[model samples]
Target: MPSAQSAARPAARSAAGVLGLAALTLLATAPRASAAEGWSLAPAGDGRPSFYAEGAPGTVLQDTVSVTNSGSHPVTVRLTGTGTGTGTGTGVPVTFAEPTVRVPARTRADVPFTMTVPAGAAPGDRSGTLLAKDADGRTATARIRLHVGGPALSALTVEHVAVHGDRITYDLVNRGTTVLVPKLAVRARGLFGRVLLDRAARTLPVRLAPGTRTGLSEPWPGRPALDAVDIRLTATAADGAHDTAGTEARFVPWGAVAGTAGALTAGAAVTVVRLRRRRAGRPAEPPPTDTYTDRDRDTDRDTDVELTGAVR
Candidate 1:
């Protein structure tokens, strides 16, 4: 038979072994509880990637954002909208039906929002992002694009045209509502109907935004030195935007021109004086003879003698 002390020792060892097994199980499951699955936030539709709305200025557009909790606990998020994409700023007006939303575990919450196009907003495409942020600072973004309804006019003009030595400078103004990548064609004609420069339409390096003006220049390295030239520039953009402007420039070597003019004036004066002297030194012609009979000849001699005596 075993001793009583040996029996007690085996019982104590069994209790310690059971306690260690319980500790191992708790350690394995604690991390899983603390770090649970996360949630997702996006547009509400089943197959939609983002939200897009179109309306005129001062119109209100509505959309929904879906917050889904895939973890085993509820999530709370604060929502906001900010302007994004091409011609919008971050301060666009956006209002949420529920700024703070609570999504239950393994479920989703759809929140509605309205975005109003400004009363003075120009006609074009604007965009923004719907932002959802949790207390833990985790963020999700849904994109939104809004197209303002109006007549899309593509108007542009080339202004302030000037020629500076070997370059042509001008300003491009976007008169209507839209962006423009302008194509420029330059033509020049000199005196005597001669074509000095002809350049085909080529795209410019700058982009013009709606209601914006940009200054630009075109190089004219091969300009003529002695002629009056008419420089014409035509600017065109997509959607039939067109404008043309012209400038006239005259180039001359003043010293050479002045010298030639002086020489011609001096030669003309000398020729005039020579012609006057020749006319003054010429002799007069004698009277013509007449056919007369002998009796007529005798009467003419007597009249001449009487006229001489009366004069004496």
Candidate 2:
């Protein structure tokens, strides 16, 4: 039999142990919840996932980004803009009003920013990111897409065309305000108007931005061994962009030609030597002699005397 006071002591100890276990569990879960509900960054207004802007070149576009601190502690973060996609330069020209912001617990900070379209920016879409980083090196990002407005012009040119052995090389230039994926066609004609090569137009594995140039080559595996060829390259892109360039190449068998030339030179030398020898070996001609001997003189005199008597 136990005393009531002792029984009450054991019950009180059990109750206190249960209470302590409950307290420990609560302490462990509280920190996890706080860490899980950490900070975030997003576009300022509405529920849009990213920021978007559109304007003409040499114009300034404005937008806002938000830094939120959902935990019980204050958060200080730094904001920056990183450029992506095909744009004028490496980074988007993002200028922030407050580059650094301090958000109170359960509060949000709105930061205003301006992105300037380059004066010579081509008409196309550019993208970037709005980034926020804290002292703990934790980072958050929000995307921004920008479109520049202008007349869409498509122009291209092929240049520096040349043939090297079994390959034809050329450069493609984008001269317009838009991006271009070019298609190439190759044609070659021999000296006698025969088509040596005719390759249909096919898509090239490159993208040409405005005012960009890229060098490319085409392979001609079974090229003519000896022929004078004219090679023409035509490049085309969307929106009526087109250009053509050409070059001439002559392939000669120099070794065979040299051998034939040497043989001909040797034959000419032999012929000249033979003619000289024939002339050198010929006998000399006899000296001229007067046939007017004493007999001849008497006959001429008698003829003259007869002629004179007849005349008389």
Candidate 3:
């Protein structure tokens, strides 16, 4: 037998409790509704500002497409490509295996895809798209253009490397390619041991031939004690404005000189010892003694106990 007011109080509290529970449930699910996933695709322009490619019939189709992430959260991207079925192609050989690849906040990455047209591919002109996605399930795409002709007379090579006092020297080969000329640059850095070298802004002005190699010679001053590898040499070549080939050379340890010195000293010592043994037949020196020898007996005792003072 409860009073009316007391009963009312419990009912009110129950209603309030229900309302609170409902509010919490709404708050918990709200994020899913507002959260968004996306990425952006922009045209990848070569430094030269050209966006088209030229390939003739009976040529291999090869080109690169880059996709970047313009998002706040990481996303996954799977790359599938499409183009006019004129050329027999392995469309986009490399890509983000999904709708999105995880791109960290405020960072962009390049996705490279190679399209190889069969020898008989109908290759007057062809195009495709490379897609990039972030984990958020957003998408981005880059356009591709290609031209096929005679063997792309592009080349790449590395040479002229010298190791001087903890430094290395080298050259890059223009191992030929069909369409693009690789702009070349060189760099030197120390191992994980953070030692980055100051490189000059110099570019090779020659169009390296299909069989010719580029020469690289620079005095890269590095840190005092380069622990892991004194200097790391890297050569970058760009074909049609894309970095195509890169090579690295390591410095030789200067300790080799010390090793050479030690060996010479040891050899010289052995030679001297051998010479001394060969001269062993020479007369030997008499052994040293505090006591007089028989020949010097007189010095020890008078030749004859001289009759002192003639029988004084």
Best by TM-score: 2
Q: Rank order by lDDT, top first? A: 2, 1, 3
Could you tell me the lDDT of residue 37 within candidate 2? 39
Compared with the true structure, all predictions reach lDDT values of 0.72, 0.75, 0.43
Pairs that collide, model 1: none
| 1-312: candidate 2 lDDT, tens digit per residue | 221111232343355355431110111111111122378887654456676677788876655666778888888888888756665333467888789888777777766667888889888778777778888888888777777778889999999999887889999999998889999999999988999999999999999989899999999998988999999999999999999999999989899999999997787677667766776898975553686578877896997677545433
- RMSD in order of candidates: 22.7, 21.5, 25.4
**Residue 63: error of model 1 in Å?**
2.2
Count clashing pairs, candidate 1.
Answer: 0
Best lDDT among the predictions, by candidate number: 2
TM-scores of all candidate predictions against the true structure: 0.58, 0.72, 0.28
Q: Write the per-residue lDDT of candidate 1 for residues 1-312, one digit (tens) a residue.
A: 221111232343355355431110111111111112387766654446666666677776665666777877778888888755475222346788788887767777767567787876667777677778888888877666676777677899999999987999999998887778999999999998799999999999987877889988999999987999999999999999999999999999899989998887777677656655765787864553575567877996997677545433
lDDT of 3: 0.43
TM-score, candidate 1, is 0.58
Better of 1 and 3 by TM-score: 1
Assess candidate 1 and give its lDDT.
Answer: 0.72
Candidate 1 vs candidate 3, lDDT winner: 1
Off by over 4 Å in 2: 1-37, 86-91, 264-312
